[model samples]
Target chain A: DTAVSQTPKYLVTQMGNDKSIKCEQNLGHDTMYWYKQDSKKFLKIMFSYNNKELIINETVPNRFSPKSPDKAHLNLHINSLELGDSAVYFCASSWTGATNEKLFFGSGTQLSVL
Target chain B: GESVGLHLPTLSVQEGDNSIINCAYSNSASDYFIWYKQESGKGPQFIIDIRSNMDKRQGQRVTVLLNKTVKHLSLQIAATQPGDSAVYFCAETYHLIYNQGGKLIFGQGTELSVKP
Candidate 1:
């Protein structure tokens, strides 16, 4: 079974459109994260949630909002997506709340904003 | 202003040759380090990890070395095969930073290419 899975492997949208990416993890992890990988392959954390509570909110713009309905699901919603948002979005989960723990990542959702 | 950066952007090696990827971190507070491998169409996968308490840790065919003095980290792969070719990244985090939500800072990444 896939430990971590995210929906819509590919997302193609217009410049001003809004969209959401869904993520789920069956590992029974307490912490879940959303990361953005730019064209240069630099991965940066956007947000993190622990047991349905918002934790880390990097300096990401307010356009990007992460919502965790429970410990197993964390979803990212992009408002008025811009061209700069064209990149791969990854969902990850770690068994412990500490960042030092090993993380299990989903394949990723490739988002292209035209 | 914490940052982790790779020394090289890409490295090409023979199939049987070993590969080494180096990374430098600016955060002295980072007590834990990890190495991740990312394939073309996938997310980063955990390969190996090392804590500040230890200078070295070995996995199946991967080894991670940490130098707390210089705040440097390296990953060495033994008998690198074609399947091992991917973008490798080094990340650092501190356990105590959980109060700040605990973030893992990833380096730019080094692309390892294995040539047959």
Candidate 2:
């Protein structure tokens, strides 16, 4: 069974369009995260939720919002996507809020804004 | 602001040879470090990790070395195979007393290519 899974493996939308990506984890982790990988392959943490509570929010713009209904699911919604939003979005989960713990990551959703 | 960065963008190695990827972190307070391998169309996979308390840790065919004095980390892979070709990233764990969970700061990835 896939420990972590995210939907819409590939997404292509026009500029100014809005989109959402869904993520789920069956590892029974307490913390979930969203990371963005740019074309340069630089992975940056955008947001993190611990047991459905917002714990970490980076310098991301307000256009991107992350919602966690529970500890098992975290979803990302982008408003008015722009060209700069083209990148791979990854979902990850960990056992606890500690950074030292191992993170299980989903395959990723490739978002391309035309 | 502190961040993690790689010294080389790409490294080419022959199959069955050893490969080394280097990373430099500016945060001296970082106590935990991890190396992740990412293949095409996939998320980063945990390879190995080390803490500030230890200088070196070994995994299956993989080794992670940490130098606290210089704030440098390296991942060494022995007998690299063709399947090992992928982008490898080094990340440092940053803790904030105000925040509930610590965050992971990732470095610019290093692409490792194994020539058959």
Candidate 3:
């Protein structure tokens, strides 16, 4: 089974449109996270949820919100997306929210806002 | 905010040759460091990791070296293959006091090209 999976492998939407990316993990992990990778290939952490609780919230704008229905699933929702929002979004999970733990990442969702 | 960065943006090596990717981090308090390999249309994959107390750790054909004194990290690949052609990133995180999770900061990443 794929350890971590995210839907909409490719997303092309209008600049002002709203979209949501779904993520699920079958690794039985307690923590899940959302990351954004820009065109320069720079990866930045957007949000993290531990046991369905918000744990980490970076400097991301309020337009981007993360929802965790459970420990095994985390979803990202963007309202009024902009051209700068075009990038690859990744979902990851770890056994625990430990610094030394290795993260299992989903293939990724490529978002293109035109 | 402190960040991790790579010295080279791209590195090219012949097949069967050894390749080394270097990274520099500014967070001196970082106790855990990891290396990740990301290929086309894929998320980053964990390659190897090293703790502050250890200077070197090896796994399969990859080895990770950590130098806390200089705040440097390096990944050494024994044999360069086409399969190994991907972007490599070094990430570091320190323990948050009284917290279980710490934020992992990734470097700019160095793209390794294995020339056939």
Q: Of the pair 1 and 3, which is ahead by TM-score?
A: 3
- The TM-score of predicted model 3 comes to 0.95
Q: Summing lDDT over every window of 10 consecutive residues in candidate 3 chain B, give the lowest-scoring window.
A: B1-10
* Interface RMSD after interface superposition, model 1: 2.8
**Alpha-carbon lDDT, every model:** 0.90, 0.91, 0.91
CA lDDT, candidate 2, residue B41? 83
- Whichever of 2 and 3 has more DockQ, that candidate is 2
Could you tell me how far off, in angstroms, the CA of residue B29 lies in candidate 1 after the best superposition? 1.0
Instruction: Please give, for residues A2-93, the per-residue lDDT of candidate 2 as tens digits.
Output: 99999999999999999999999998999999999888788899999999999999999999999999899999999999999999999999
Interface RMSD of each: 2.8, 2.7, 2.8
Residue B75's lDDT within candidate 1 is 94
Candidate 2 chain A, run of 10 with poorest lDDT:
A96-105
Query: Between which residue pairs do clashes occur in model 1?
Result: none
DockQ of each: 0.65, 0.69, 0.63
lDDT string for model 3 (A16-114, tens) is 999999999998999999999988888999998999999899899999999999999999999999999999999999998888888888999999999
